[model samples]
Target: DAGITQSPRYKITETGRQVTLMCHQTWSHSYMFWYRQDLGHGLRLIYYSAAADITDKGEVPDGYVVSRSKTENFPLTLESATRSQTSVYFCASMGVAGDNEQFFGPGTRLTVL
Candidate 1:
């Protein structure tokens, strides 16, 4: 496995501002997912994509948008940042099936001020 990585490992932003977190993998995995880690909720799914250009909403996608125009890259954007959205975001990718082990990026810590 080539593994996965994320950009801007740490970020601090104000509420109402737009911010984006980038994720890239070299394994060419068929499935990718975005999730956020919070204090109480633990980890909540934000979005996922089965393939390039094919995406879907996950559990908490209200303030976020995602796109997968290429198999190796999936980026998550917060249209308007909110304090509640501040959390550590993780990007993960899996092979053929969802049951397969998912390779996760280092994570991006976003703090909405």
Candidate 2:
């Protein structure tokens, strides 16, 4: 496949647990991003990676972390899951920031109890 894909389309976990969501892309895009969509908030960036071994924090990167060890894969980890973190996580990739369009994965719905 040439598009991006996310694993564990749905997940349920208790609060204070650690969970990792997987994201894979076949385009070998240079830019990978993690975002969470809540009810009212459209989309908030959690983390983004420019390339392999290069990662940066975004607007809402407090409880979430990301790594890009490979250009085609970027994984997001929740250090300590909370009820407030229960939201749909979306993974996206783009060739370049200003010159390319972003492609989003299906998304992973996480529920924290």
Model 2 Cα lDDT, one tens digit per residue, 1-113: 66999998999999999999999999888999999999999999999998899999999999888888789999999989999999999999999756788999999999999
Clash number for model 2?
0
Q: Residue by residue across 1-113, what tens digits does model 1's lDDT show?
A: 36899999999999999999999999889999999998878899999999999999999889899999999999999999999988999999999956688888999999999
Tell me which residue pairs clash in candidate 2: none
Choose the strongest candidate by TM-score.
2
Model 1: how far residue 23 lies from native, Å: 0.2
Report lDDT (Cα) of residue 81, candidate 1. 96
Q: Which ten residues in a row have the lowest lDDT in candidate 1?
A: 95-104
Over the full model, what C-alpha lDDT does candidate 1 score relative to the true structure? 0.93
